[model samples]
Target: VTIIANLELKKQQLVLPKNALREAFRISHAIAEVTNVSSSARQPYVGVSAFAHKAGLHASAIKIDPSLYQHEDPASVGNDMRMLVSDMAGRASIELKSQELGVDLGGDKELIGRIVDRVKEMESRGFTFEAADASFELLVHEEVNGKRPSFFTIEHWLTTVERAEDQSILTKAEVTVTALGKKIICTGIGNGPVNAFDNALRTGLKQLYPELEVLELTDYKVRILEGRLGTGAITRVLVETTDGKGEWNTVGVHENVIAASAMALEDALTFGLLRQGRKPE
Candidate 1:
């Protein structure tokens, strides 16, 4: 039972221990894991998107007093409010999101303005940072540090698909990456182009950062924007990755679907490396 459900049950005079209410999200997620069922992101109190705020107007009110928008204190149910940064974000939204991600913009009005402009411009190009916090955080860090962390340089990546004589489809990918001042070439075979490319890149980098071996791609989603153009439309790819303990999302946009997937995959690995506390070479 969830805190929301229990609250409703309590209205019927059913009693639930305070400790049980405190463990609401944990219990719901634990059940999901044991049953191998995914919890809805929109589930009432425990969903990932349940407490996510996207509107700039709401963010302004939240900045003034979170209670202005929240029906109840999120912490009372083991959840925290999330301020999403998007094209519609204002200074207050950026400030709150930056603080949430532990980035110290120091309330620099000029820098926040630049970030707002960047978010708007990028969103216009089909990049949706709201769903990809890893990529968004990376963007924030790039703006704050004047550059992105360089974990490795990809010289080239290529994927090929072929139908075998047995009528089975095979995909192979080759990647050349420079890491730790060494250039390495690796190849991998998988069920799809993106999977093959992911394997090739990780196989090459596992030499320098063994911690990457634990990183796994959990979900992949693609959306075609400007669908009127059919195959020629811009493609946006969102990838979810986990390092056993936590998960994060990254996004990419390109005219070529494979290229878009490659961009998302790169960001996924880069963010995973960052999570491992490995300094860029």
Candidate 2:
């Protein structure tokens, strides 16, 4: 049999018998098995799901034997196989997901029919659940609970702007928030609407959580839709922020660019506070 041995850097060469070729193949396979298991443990967040297929003929082949298409069984790489149903899906696929969710296929025909119809309708509207998995989870919870959230509420807001020469602008934003038998009003000033809004949000939240810090705005982007005269069009704003530990993104859309940026800014701050385990004031 082929023998395998670990040697120090100074003793790198190993003299072996010519008949040990078969043993070498076995040793190589054994080493490969161990390396595969070790590397899989270090796989990052995306992992195998980063490139799994779940549509068209590929899904069918995988369902038969994952080895047929997938480089490895999804489970081997710490990923569970998934199939996304859309307009292109057949009834079999729908039934599979329903059964997996523990829905009674025989008696729940009407509900299943409605779900498939709704999925098709929502997909047409650019509503995708693949990227925003948390949103999708919340949607499922709301559907099952039929319960409204009873959390903090925004009472009112006022924003004032002052224009200066050389394209410089100043903005002051004020917000009234009500939560947990308390009402707080805060105001802040900044170079732009989003900055002013974030400052106001932070001021309000800091009253409750004084240890909150290290949060900073990293980037902001705005896209104008329906370019009518290239001015007064629907604007979509994307905000990116980090809290020293991790970063997140949030988006808002509106006809007013400033309003869109303000909404996005509020979302970013709220998300950051949530991540820090503090409730918004």
Quantify all predictions' global Cα lDDT against the true fold.
0.87, 0.55
Clashing pairs in 2: 2-23
Candidate 1 ranges with C-alpha deviation above 4 Å = 2-14
Per-model TM values vs. the true structure: 0.95, 0.54
User: lDDT tens string, model 2, 39-87?
Assistant: 2312322232433444546655654676786543443223455555555
The per-residue C-alpha lDDT of model 1 at residue 124 equals 98
lDDT of 1 by residue, 101-189 (tens): 88888989999998999999999999998999899888888898899877988899899999989999999999999988899999999
Q: Which ten residues in a row have the lowest lDDT in candidate 1?
A: 6-15
lDDT of 1: 0.87
Say which candidate scores most in lDDT. Answer: 1
TM-score of 2: 0.54
